[model samples]
Target: MPNYTLLTRQLEALLDDRDWLINAAQTCAFIMQQVPELNWAGFYLQRQPELLTLGPFQGKPACNPIPFSKGVCGGAARSRQTQRIDDVHAIADHIACDAASNSELVVPILRQGTLWGVLDLDSPRHGRFDEVDQAGIEALVEVFNARTDLPDFLSSH
Candidate 1:
């Protein structure tokens, strides 16, 4: 298990740039660097209705424009809830951007009750994430949200 307490403090310190784009990029890099066994760490920005466009990420090439009705990222966006899967292969609609990714954790990013996007983390090992990880990552995300001035992308919705 990671030292989430320390990770949280580090994230807060690293987020010196409050710009959403910069923060997103830094957050992805931080997760990939600090977390072990992660194959992918990134963000899926909901620029359009019911769709998530690829944002800053660290990994191999990825799938673009995931719909809210499809995949784990979509499920998190559609439901506005965190989705932590022990085995991505078991998900019938799992979007296999990386065949090596066996597990996934996606947290919805909301601004003023409106959807902004999602923070997605994928791992090559099955069951790589547990409740502790979920809570820790969620807290880290809270730090992102608190520090960054994320635009209300869906304000017009």
Candidate 2:
């Protein structure tokens, strides 16, 4: 198992700036570089109500504009909860952005009680994440929230 304590500390140090976009992007790269067996690590920003648009990621291409009524990411966004799935194929509505991704972990990112986005991690190994990972990632997301000054309205222009 990876040392989440060290990882979170590294994340805190990596995020020197408060720019949401830059931090989000760096977080993805950090997770991808540090974590093992991961195929994808990224974010899906909820730019509109009940919708998730693609954000910074460290992986191949991905799906975009997911609705609240769809896949694992959607479930996390809609329910405002973290989702840890051991098998992606078992999910009826699993979004297959990468066929090699067998498992998934999605953590809901909130800003002052409002849904901001989700930090998504996909692994090629089955059951890649567990309770420890869940807790650690949640803590990392909290650090991100604390460090980032995410504005209420982010213009796409």
Candidate 3:
């Protein structure tokens, strides 16, 4: 695994730019580059209480406007917890934005105790994400949550 300490530092520096969209985009791009076996890395911001709109992502086209009621991403958002599936295919309702993805890790992003959004990472290889990854990604999500200003994307309703 790459050095998460270094990665986190780099993330902090990038976030110094303070343009949420650009920083979010850089976060996706940076993780995709550092992590191995990952085919997709991205964010889905809560546009409303029941919907998540796609943000910066690195991969093939992904599912946009994910509802709060469905899929792994939805599960994380609704529960405000991380979802790390060893085999996404086993989940009866797994949303296959990329058919190649066999495993996934979705971490919910919270800001001031509110459901902000999620950082979703996918891999073509099963058992791709483990505890180490969960820890690292959770740290990354902390960086994102602390630095990002998300009101620009969320809706009042």
The models' CA-based lDDT, in order, is: 0.94, 0.92, 0.89
Query: Compared with the true structure, what per-residue lDDT tens digits does model 3 show for residues 71-126?
Result: 99999999999999999999988889999999999999887788778999999999
Clashes of 3: 0
Candidate number achieving the greatest TM-score relative to the actual structure: 1
Clashes of 2: 0
> lDDT tens string, model 2, 46-136?
8887889999999999998899899999999989999999999999999999999999999999877889999999999999999999999
Clashes of each: 0, 0, 0
Overall local distance difference test of candidate 3: 0.89
Best by lDDT: 1
Better of 1 and 3 by lDDT: 1
Q: Give candidates' CA RMSD values in order.
A: 1.2, 1.6, 1.3
Error of 2 at 47 (Å): 0.5
Q: Worst ten-residue run, lDDT, model 3? A: 148-157
**Model 3 stretches with alpha carbons more than 4 Å out:** 155-157
